[model samples]
Target: MEPEKLRKRINELAAKKKKEGLSETEEVERAALRAEFLANFRQAFRSQVEMMQVFDKAGKEVTPEKVREIQRKKGLRDD
Candidate 1:
């Protein structure tokens, strides 16, 4: 689902939990939704980081080896 909708549902569940306790099914649904949200966030973050390139003041590329390796595997960078 969209991030905003996911966030809204999670927040709603959280508010419900804080005000009135949730049933067993609601608790399970909340956990699953939270896990899904985290997975989506991690994937988006990883994609962003994989596409990033860092340069030093002297214009030397300073991206980390792990990130460079990922870029190389994806044919996004040379050397």
Candidate 2:
């Protein structure tokens, strides 16, 4: 689902919960929507992290080897 719509439904369910509460089906739907939201958030964050470069005060790179390896595998690094 689109992120905006997903959030809208989640917020609606939360407000309903605070007011009158949800049925069992709505509870399940809310859980699934939240999980999907978190997964999408994590994926976007991981991509941002992967494309980053880290440096030290002396201009030498101090990026972790694991991150470098991922960059290389994705063709982001030539060295």
Candidate 3:
């Protein structure tokens, strides 16, 4: 294709996108939702960190492998 044709096509698409109105209110709503999501994520992250600290200080490692071993030793597996 010609360079001028490509430029015209690009400009047309840009204009169309601009006309579609990706709104400021929508952006503000998205930011508010994201802030709430991040706050919840941080809370959960801190809780997990605290849980790990307690597990470490209490001298117990809550690993899947350890749970599996305990289950095996106790004959707790149905299969």
How far is each candidate from the true structure, as Cα RMSD in Å? 1.0, 0.8, 14.6
Candidate 1 versus the native: TM-score? Answer: 0.91
Give the per-residue lDDT digits (tens) of candidate 2, residues 3-73: 99999999999999999999999999999999999999999999999999999999999988999999999
Q: What is the lDDT of residue 32 in candidate 2?
A: 100
State TM-scores per candidate: 0.91, 0.95, 0.41
- Write model 1 residue lDDT over 1-79, tens digit each, in one string: 8889999999999999999989999999999999999999999999999999999999998999999999999999877
Global Cα lDDT for candidate 1: 0.96
The candidate 2 region of ten consecutive residues with least summed lDDT is: 60-69
Model 3 lDDT per residue over 1-79, tens place: 3445544554554565578854576556545555565676697875564433224567785546645555566675433
**Model 2 clash pairs?**
none
lDDT of the candidates, in the order given: 0.96, 0.97, 0.54
Off by over 4 Å in 2: none
Over 4 Å off, model 1: none
Better of 1 and 2 by lDDT: 2
